[model samples]
Target: MTILIGCAHGTRDEQGQETIHRLVEDIRTALPGKEVREAYVDVHGPFVADVVAEVAAEESCSAVVVPLLLAGGYHVYHDIGEAVKDRADVVAAPALGPDPRLIDIVMDRIREAHIPDTATLILAAAGSSDPRSQADTEAAAEMLRARWSGPVRIGYAAGIHPTVDDAVADARANGEDFEVAVASFLLAPGFFQKRLTESGADHVTEPLAPHPRLVEIVLDRYRDAGGS
Candidate 1:
């Protein structure tokens, strides 16, 4: 039997870990016969490599590593790829964020905010030091902007420039009378989301946790990973 491994960035926050754990459970139930497991890339326990090694040894099966992350950042390229190396059995799926369905989540957040046309929208990501990661974030932002009517700007909490504050400032400079609605492009409540909130955005939407559609997306990744 092939193992469906859901890999997350991991956080010290117990609540955050619990949320991801629950997501994995949802995926497991979606494929009752498959052996599903969870792992983290950092901070939390059961690292991806360890989980891969454990499942490969136990089931004598290859695995697919589906990132719970939002985009094809460093975790997808360097960390996850390196961890799965030498294990010909493992295949990594696309990041969770760029999935077309994500636009629905983002749109919902915006609509839920009751954001006014006068308000400028700021899509905030956790941000990565990796240029490729930022590029992916920008790509998502562009997709969102194309569909959104209001002024939208892409910003990060850490890594690259134009942080949440910077995005707000840019919007204000553009004479947007910026409300700076923060559309958190994260999967769960974590440090980055908290920091973005504290950064003084006028409005901040919660992360995309416990979303029913997300469960469907995860299952698709698992099946596409070659799970039977």
Candidate 2:
């Protein structure tokens, strides 16, 4: 069986870490008898390189490192890619984002938040310096806009503008007089998700975590990499 290594950008929040771990467990449940291991790229132990090294040493097992990130960033492209560089048996999978099922989950979370139809949505994400990452986020915004008739804007948590607060302020200043809502594009309840609350929006949706679609995406990524 091919070993699936679930890699994520770790968080300091206890629940955030637990969320990733639980997601990995869910993957294990979905793929019984396959070794599913959890790993972190930052802010935690059990790094990707170590996991890849250990799994590569195992007998008769190929490893696939699937990132739990939303887009291709430094961590996914550089950190993860470098981990399994020389390992013949290990493959790095693409980051999960800009997928239809994920968009469905985002819509579900927005509906659950009771965001009114007339509201302006700010799709807030943890920013990345990588151009590809920003492009992926822009693509996600376009996808959301296709389903939502109201105004939809993209905002960053750390690296880029307009920030969430700025997006909210822009919405308020608009002549349409729409109610402002923030769609948290984060994967879990971590520091970045918490920043959404301070965005001054009328409503903020919950982060996408432990969703069944996430498991599907993980599996898809692994499969796309030709991992058994």
Candidate 3:
């Protein structure tokens, strides 16, 4: 059977690590009798390249590296891409975002935060220098806007323009009468999540993992890349 490598941008936060581990376990449970493993593109390891090389060496075994990241960026195009590019038996799947179900999770988080309809919403992501990543984030914001009647804006935790702090400040300035809520576009708790919490918004939603829809997305990505 083909192996499913659930690769994530690793984190130092223990809870973040646990959250990602749980996601891999869920994928394993969802695809019984198949080999499922976890790898990382940064912070910690077994790193993606090492994992992919190992899988490639195994006879009769091909693998799909499904990014647990919310958007495509350096990690997706460089790290994960380089890991599988040399091996015919290993292929990489697309990042998980710009999907309706993830927007549903973001909306769920917004509602759980008790954010009012009048609140200006900022979709805050861990930014990347990659334009593709920025475009993916913008697409996600558009999706959120369609479902939400309130104003929606985009912000970044790092590596791009209009930091979350700035986004929140701008929203507060433009809509003095309205509260500013940040919808975290992150996958799990970590440094970025902490940054979002301190972004000066009236409220900030939780990260988008530990959700069943995420597991479904990972599975779909794996299958889309030709994983059995």
Candidate 4:
């Protein structure tokens, strides 16, 4: 069996756990024949290494560790990659960010949130200490800014530059009654999402969950990875 592992940067919130579980179920439904497992990098149960070891031991199968993260960061390189190191049967796929489809998703969120050109939009990601992660978020923000026709700022919930509060403050200082619409650049609702909401932003968009388009993206990645 081909084991498709949905790896999340785990959260302490129970609601976050539920959201990831739901996504895993949707992923399984998308790839019916494949066995799916949800694992976390930290702050929750079933670390990626343990999950890989458990599944590889039981099934002697090829494992695909798909990060539910927004960009290539420490978790992608160190944690998830390390998890698959001892397991010859496992391969780690790219993080679920920076894909062209994600641009479309961001546009969708903007439209759904009814953000105006006057609105100072913040693409708030669960930031990383990794510079690459911040850069990726900026790249994604640039893509969105191209199509958005508005001031789109890249902000982080934690870790690095122009944090949510800073984004809001900067926009406010710019002298417009900016509508702070949050495009959650996260795969699931977690502490970051909660922080974004509590950050007193004017509006918040939903996380990129198991939307149909996202399911298609996951399946496409599996195919691209040479999965059957």
Question: For model 1, what is the alpha-carbon lDDT of residue 218?
Answer: 77
Candidate 4: worst 10 consecutive residues by lDDT? 218-227
lDDT of 3 by residue, 1-228 (tens): 689999999999999999999999999999999999899999989999999989988889999999999989899999999999979889999999779999999989998999999888999999998999999999999999998888999999998889999999987777556888999999999999999999988999999989999999999999999998
Question: Which segments of candidate 2 are over 4 A away from where they belong?
Answer: none
Query: Model 1 TM-score?
Result: 0.93
Q: Estimate each model's TM-score.
A: 0.93, 0.97, 0.98, 0.92
Q: What's every prediction's RMSD, in angstroms?
A: 1.6, 1.0, 0.8, 1.7
Per-residue accuracy of model 1 over 1-228 as CA lDDT, tens digit each? 778889999998878888998888888888878888898888867898788778657646888888888887788887788877888788888777677688788778777877766667788888888777787788888888888777888888887788987887778777776477888888887788888788777888888876778887777777777766
Best by TM-score: 3
Error of model 1, residue 13, in angstroms = 1.7
Flag the better candidate by lDDT, 2 or 4: 2
- What are the per-residue Cα lDDT tens digits for candidate 2 across 38-87? 99999987999899988888898798999999988899989999998988
How much is 27 displaced in model 1, in angstroms?
1.0
List the pairs of residues colliding in candidate 4. none
Candidate 3 has which clashing residue pairs, if any?
Answer: none
Runs in model 4 lying further than 4 Å from the true structure: none
lDDT of 4 by residue, 156-181 (tens): 88887789878877888888575767
For each candidate, what is the lDDT? 0.81, 0.90, 0.93, 0.80
